[model samples]
Target: MSTVTLQEKKSYRIMGISLPLFGLITVGVLTATYMEVLPKGMIGAFALMMVLGLILNEVGNHLPIVKDYLGGGSIVIIFGSAALVTYNVLPESAVEIMSNFMRGEGFLDFYIAALITGSILGMNRELLIKASVRYLPAILGGVAVALGLVGLVGAIIGYGAKEAILYIGVPIMGGGMGAGAVPLAQIFGSSLGVDSGEMLSVMVPAVALGNAVAIVVAGLLDRLGKTKPNLTGNGELMELENKKAEAKEEVEEKEEKTAINFPMMGRGLLLAVSFFTLGSIIGKFLPQVHSYAWMIISVAVVKALNILPREYETGAFQWFQFVMTNLTGVLLIGIGVAFTNLQQVIDAFTIQYVLLVAVTIIGCVIGSGIIGKFVGFYPIESSITAGLCMANMGGTGDVAVLSASDRMKLMPFAQISSRIGGAFMLILASTLLRFFI
Candidate 1:
């Protein structure tokens, strides 16, 4: 190893000391604020949560074994924040404010809007078309296997085959909160003559737990790819043969379009929000479909039809990069504090509970990986996008799992799993529940 420079060593020492000092000071401030000695409000709550998320993320990113196997700080920011709230380290008021910012203030929606708009628009038209068609079967395979395996595991664990598939499997395999569990609860509740609230109470935990497990498994898969490089595409979701003759001119043409300027970024932002709004308006009219789904369709049509100019696509990609790099920590913190419930997860601590969820995730990976190979995708890439993405917590989970696997460029595929795959879940649930009930 190269010897460290004195300046670098000094910087490291400073960081080592400053981080702990900052922690003690932050604790003092939080305690005073909790007691009403320091002023408390949204500002403090957001700032503190951001700080915690970033710090936790940094620590998780660098922790030796964790960075390799558990997706580092992405998982940490979430479960760690939940732990703070559960242990009363985070005061209820602060947690509530953070929750409101995420849900009531719509931060999660904001992040998803930007990500979906940018990713879909930025894709190569031909590649997008080729990928989307092949991707669906991979997603279906994941869903089928995940539900089947969870049911089998549940039976062995005495969780019952029907209950396992109906409650644990569907919920865990469902998209995520608003799009996944909420609608599923309504469908199942109506069929079973039980209240929606009761169904949600049963479903939410499975979704949360499944999301957590998916993220961790993604990290493990990343490590596996590193140790055995042949199994992965290394960010290319499709198969490639570097030694063969290829379409060099097409790549050059795509590269030429990637010019950047401030005005272009602004245009990109406007286009993104406008597309998101169009989806929202459509969603208002079509209550059955999620806005993101509509947005994906609208953008995909525009891309496939070559309606948008090349410059605008580049702009969207640049804008997405900026937002993902800067605001990801903030969004993750919000998910942990607002969306995760420590008590609920804790209450779900049973062998059957954990085993069933594990089986669901494994089923997703296996089903998607196998199907993806036949459809001309790399097995690992297919599993991540088609399987784990379906098993995750919708949009936010998409970001977390993709980040963990170091494949943020696969956002479009990830969104498909969340939006379209989630839609498929609703349809399947509606049909299956009738038989089960």
Candidate 2:
């Protein structure tokens, strides 16, 4: 234990010393973005550097334009890489195993549990962010409802409850195709009696196809929307104007402030540890223990409770960001490495397998798109969100899809609504299907 602690400290120290190197790279890249002439490989390099830049920021340093742009960019990188890997668009072995373990009746236990836990934690975080923020109450309340449903469904269905689980995870993870093949594997496992090894390979292509389906559908929607502008409503115009005003205010505030000072690292670390422990305790006691869910939820809840003051110290925010960034990085990197071991799954794709994937993709696009339209989002935005659900087939994808579409100037609230509905159905349907199929 002592050795490990020492090593960890040493690693952090090394990271601290190495911060400037990353900052330098980030600055160089930012200059390019400003000039609108960033090279190709620089794009990937920039994405990778953003996370490092945030770490540097936490430790107290500045690297010109890099600090501002790259830090936030890290969030994007974390999101995008996870999306690519989760959907099997990227050939990473760790994703294969995790996705497999994530699939089916057995898989639902952990994920659904996590969904519940994350919401609870997120609410606590929301409270910390601002109790008066009008949106927090409703959102947190919805999360509670979703959590309860997930736990109830998981307890009753067991491993067969994967479809239900996917529905839940899909919205949470990244929406549609990014939601990935865990649900299909669940279905295949229970209904077809397919082995885990065989199912892993079956799911990869399905995930990719789902994502592709989403993109194509979204693109088509974009084209269609061009012909009928603002069919989605003009609520976003107001939102955009407000955001711009907020940005200007923030810029003025930054000028008045000295060096950015985040809160101490201790608080976030303590909160993270608390949540991890709490999750473990809850997961163990739950009828069908899903520890990961507990861990995730606990983290969010603990952080929320600990950090939700109206006037948080700068150091506190910095530490909290660090903790979250590190947590996300470790989990994702672990998933990436883990997927490397599942080569067998991809080696034996059959005709039936191909068809199954095709159908799933189609279903995701059509289902998600219809839901988006009903919610009054621009067609492109709705389709992307739908595609995210249908393709990678998860919430993270939903966020990414929505965010991506927003970049393309599409209305994204539809994405949010789609997720709310899709996640509920995805989990419930998947779990219930187990018994009949």
- List, in order, the clash count of every candidate structure: 0, 73
What digit string (tens of lDDT, one per residue) describes model 1 on residues 12-62? 322244545556656776676577444344466556666676678878878
- Tens digits of per-residue lDDT for model 2 on 74-185? 2233334445555665433323333443332133333333333332333323223432232222322333333344444544545223433333323332233212233333
The lDDT, on a scale of 0 to 1, for candidate 1 is 0.74
Model 1: per-residue Cα lDDT at residue 252: 20
Error of 1 at 132 (Å): 2.5
Query: Which residue pairs overlap in candidate 1's backbone?
Result: none
Model 1: residues with Cα > 4 Å off, grouped in runs:
1-45, 91-93, 151-260, 376-437
